[model samples]
Target: MRPRFRRRNVASEGTESLGPSIPDGLWSKCPRCRELIYTREFERNHSVCPRCGYHARLTARQRIALIVDPESFVEWDAGLSPADPLQFVALGEPYPRKVAEAQERSGEREALVTGAATILGVPVGLAVAEFGFLGASMGSVFGEKFARAAERAAVEDRAFIVFASSGGARMHEGVFSLFQLPKTIVAVESLSERRLPFITVLVDPCYGGVTASFATVADLILAEPGAMIGFAGPRVIEQVTRQKLPAGFQSAEFLLQHGMIDAIVPRPRLREELAHYIRLLTNQHSASPVSFVTRQESDR
Candidate 1:
């Protein structure tokens, strides 16, 4: 006969912790469909709810990986730091400490990470907003990084791409952050003077000063499906207007219908579409003899 087996309590042994794990169907409630879905499933769909097509928030790193060519990104301004100019304190935490914590969590020194990279073999300058950092608000560093990226693109004769996802200007930084709006705008204007193509990819929850500035100045604006692109949030608008906002107000689809966005690109197609647009705008085909023939025929 087999020896008597002993059953050990895994929890007591610290081999495993005992708790009620969230079920596969209990992750999120879709605002549009009123259905709950597994978080894993939602992520698998690139944060689009399978049932309602609702877009979920994405981190800056994730956005960069999804859009740029694999292993092609080299970050810029990774050492620039945010200053607590106002020395603001909230909930017993200093603003600088909050920024440090955000950096730790996001592995980014600032809310925006600007860099030079190749997307589909086309060299371009890219900036992605880290929404995890104080809602990806624009501070002095964010402005400086953007301006530097734009300047770099112009100097290198490359295109510029920006992924804008933000709540607004950083409230903790006060007016200094607000000044970034004009600063970034001027940088983008410099790109225009160089005749370099500037593409803006609007992610979910892109709003406020960002929407009013660099996000709006791109030569080609692409918005993720179901993203929210607006100056003010729905709740704030509703409260100010004293009326209930319509469903899907400020959504990417809504903005596309209103001519605010050039295209509503699905996540999977974004990279290819962006590459194609960059190739076209940069006249990549012009370097080929075949393209010259095609151009001549078209002119005829």
Candidate 2:
């Protein structure tokens, strides 16, 4: 005779007495800490997980709002959208349709947004990448927008700032996507020739061509806490090299330790950090000569 076991039913076991199931949109789970947090609280904290301090990804508009002064952001290249130069199709889906879906989801014309804004009242040209749009892949339009943004910085005699949140080059556009690498590098070199300050904030999951080009050419390279920053992801690198990776590989903290980035900044402190560096590099707001020397040394 087998032992009889009763199967308890969660629905019929008076589970409703747990005071109503939590509403879906009211709470968010922290991926790092695995803790439930109030959604409003998470947003107020700039999307950082309170329990474990995981910096969550933000949309371009949200990032802009977080970094710039109130009503100070005036966007550039808003009308420029990517063209399917190769008439690309992937997985039974047309490239244009894929782009349209990304646009609808992100509410942006492209993956990158360039603009002029005041960070803590210091004027600067800003480019923010929207990961919500096709993983913020670099396309011809993305390159164009970035180049124009750098040019605007040169013209305005202001520091240029970029918030890079990308997966890599946009493959849908074919070789045209790869061409953006040199194009954007030329733009960065233009600023370098003019002795203008260029800064980049490497957000979570920044990788591939964007990382290879304009993103890392900035005079000041900053990153959000725990951001994954590398040319190739750990899994890919490990597989190709047939070697094990180190702990915290490609994370912001790891990069900081290796002297690859200037700082690992938390989301809430990012605006202040950017403003501080901008002022130091541009000799604004009475930035001292000592601080300028420190910045130069760090850049080297």
Candidate 3:
């Protein structure tokens, strides 16, 4: 007969249990400061760590809700989804399967979310990248959505704004992904033909082809505190050049000091600042600040 083993219970064996177990996800550790913070408080603060001021990434919906006027957003290109033209496979997993997994994980059809919305009563075209969706990689559908949104903004004569967070272009799509670089650049140019303002807010971990293309070619470029904005990450650059980089390399503050970005706007002040810029850029600054401030404060 085969020998049988029995599992032992620590409680029955007289080992003391640590008090009632704490539930999972009740607290989140700050990546920068390594402090445990209550999840509710973290969400209330817009995902910025209270201790170290780390601006955690937000879901696309959360970002839209934070930036746009309540119930004012109407999405576009909702049916557009990614396709595997190359029939690509990685480590025996098909591209379509990967995309399906990403869709399930992110609860979004594609990485890019484009829509029309009002900010502080001023209409604008908006696009926010969902990093949870395949690192917000720019694939064909991603490019199409952005191009269409830009075209719509130009046609409607509204300022266009984008909150960009990406790990660059999708490698699964191969060369088709690289096609988006110039395509989006042309789209931005179309906006300029109508003299519409194009603004981009670069969030954390924005790099690769997206940054190389349209993310930087804006009327104004703003970044959150400590965002990593660059074509190649510091690690790759250091590896290539075989040299040590300066402290804070590729950070938003570093980019700002180097004149790559216009301003570093904290998350709380972002809406007001964007409204101020929109009003100034579009020559619509005649509105009284008292009414606007009151409305904004009440909403907050």
Candidate 4:
């Protein structure tokens, strides 16, 4: 008989350079309750903790798949890339290298992905944030993508929809990044002037510049269950005001009850709800046929 092939442990091959092992099959710790549960179980609940209802970060692809029609998405600005204007370096790595690493981890070149797709056959422009990219901070590329997406929507006369999830402006990009806040806001305003419907879906941990700008200006705002939407994070607010925040102060459900959000949408129902809105808006604005208008004029 041939020698029994032994299973070699490849886990240690990259250990020396890659550092210590992450606990395998460990559940994500709940930020609020500090409870540990299975990751698979958390995912099954749409990334919400069953114990304390903590929202977990979601990937751009996951959001896209959740919100867009299958086989319908066509991505935009896929070639746009970040530039190292400051030539900054930190932790033995250049800024550009860090950006590349973030992109690799997120499977996206920037924090946001802009695209066109239908939700239940209603055409709309979509922009989803990839939180894996340095907490989906707004930078030059992010701003460019948002502006371009808005312009595209205006040109196509399609509804503009954005899923905003970010920790705010990218610090590495400095003031240049902050400038994008107003820039994106202006683009959204232009869309508003055209009477186009702009919808925003707030995801967990949306704060900083993002909450103050384009996110707050949407014609209709829907937030994911258990998301946090605010200008400053709870920690910062606590430190600045020296006041303890109430439990679930910034949660999506809390905001919904307080009339801040139009609705608290669960992951599965997001597409259906968006489609209903799109169809309503499209029908409300659709022009009557030329023949019908001419017949009306003749009767008059």
Candidate 5:
């Protein structure tokens, strides 16, 4: 028999502690394992915890820096911004105002950031969504940019890669937003039509129309560990079906077990793993070891 338990938290009931605050975002607590992680080491480790191997959320710019070869990324459709055709208003802010605020705060015109870049000297079209921007919701601009990225990949004979992180289609856009689902599906279909390899990297909290569409229709679908990937959230699913979901349901690991995803990848190994797959599919030549040293010094 064990002794009766006493609460470890001394804080008052109905209140929560967010842990010790750190300046400049250098320290954080892991949600899964409750381990404290140093941000510098976390970034060096590609936002993965050295202790428990948990993957942390990353911004679009951070991802680009980690994945692409140095100075190789070129922006595509950099000037496009969403329009307020419906003039939506909510929470005392107009739709356009909200869009502007999100853009200013995130430093992106839309949630999606797309471009062409070389992965280990292999040309590929890259699109990464910023979940910091309005939950990375998909709007018409998001779909259009992805279509352009896919088309560019086909034209350049390069592989297409998209890092998907979204809550769903933008609710503020109404039916017009929903239309983007089929539109993006058609764009993804073009990749298949052109016989171009399309890979999707599903980030945390991928769901709704985006997940239901091109996100799942990839030649190879990979997800970061512990990412939430599903059509609807677990709570909604439970509410609708009135059944308890299996433990860890809708997680990237759960999806892999159910044959929904190809594999769970860590951020640090993503570039190498993706390049390996691309080379295998394209029959590209083997790459030399990466080095910035001169040939004479290397031979010596």
Candidate 6:
């Protein structure tokens, strides 16, 4: 039999770290509630803070498991890795070397994981961004993955859902990286032609070229509580405008008040929320939970 057991990861409680090298049985302090929580239990609750209901950041894999049906995710573009086409360097480290180090740390080839999955037995195309991978910055590859996810969803008549969590465009890649904004927008804009639903789930710290492009143009935009969403970082915007920004200017709740997004979804209810929207948009009635079965299984 294949070995199924894995080594333990030693991350602090309630924090999300899936790698086996992390130290185990550590406790984590909730940033919002200031309460100590067992790391294992925190993961069991899907990384949401039990005391104050704050949603913790999740790894790309953990995020995928939250909404997709068990064993139903078929990933695409997993081999795509970031390249230092510009031969860029920053902070005294070469860009390619930096990307290599980041890949090692995050256990992902790139920041985004694109795939087909079923949410509540309703097929949907999903793309989740991993923030731990170099702040989940969008490079050429990241944009390509996002674009292809939208295309796949459109072609398959499935709802397209993107989880956006980024610090912005990868500065290391320079202009080549920034240009992907338009590329992704073109891909996202194509979804409308098919009348497929496109949803953006804005996570923490979404800013820069990402917010200025495809992320803001979703058919329905949903943000997690306290997510910072804006075209620029608050400090930079304040400097440019030379004004004292209001408190929580770019927070998820703030965006909702300004009519920037459709709604603010709590972590616990996100699956239900997305399923509801997908069903209405697709005219799909309630589907019983159906696993992917082979022709032989069906015949049997």
Top candidate on lDDT is: 3
**TM-scores vs. true structure, each candidate:** 0.81, 0.87, 0.87, 0.79, 0.85, 0.85
Candidate 4 achieves a global lDDT of 0.82
lDDT of 3 by residue, 190-284 (tens): 79998889999999879999999999999999999988889987778889999898878889999999999999999978988998898888788
lDDT of 3: 0.87
Residue-level lDDT tens digits of model 2 in 131-200? 8899999999999999999988888877899999788889999899999999999987767878888999
Error of 5 at 205 (Å): 0.9
* lDDT (Cα, 0-100) at 287 in candidate 4: 44
lDDT of 2: 0.85
**Would you list the C-alpha lDDT of every candidate in the order shown?**
0.83, 0.85, 0.87, 0.82, 0.84, 0.84
Lowest lDDT sum, 10 consecutive residues, model 3, at 1-10
110 in model 6: Cα distance from truth in Å? 0.9
The C-alpha stretches of model 4 lying farther than 4 A from their native spots are 1-55, 284-300
Please give me the total number of clashing residue pairs in predicted model 3.
0
After superposing candidate 2, which stretches have Cα over 4 Å from the reference? 1-23, 286-300
Model 1 residue pairs with clashes? none
- Angstrom error of the Cα, residue 39, model 6: value is 3.0
TM-score of model 6 vs. true structure: 0.85
Candidate 1 structure quality by residue, lDDT tens digits, 100-125: 89989878888998898888888889
lDDT of 6 at 146: 90
Name the lDDT value of residue 159 in candidate 1. 90
**Model 5 regions more than 4 Å off:** 1-26, 287-300
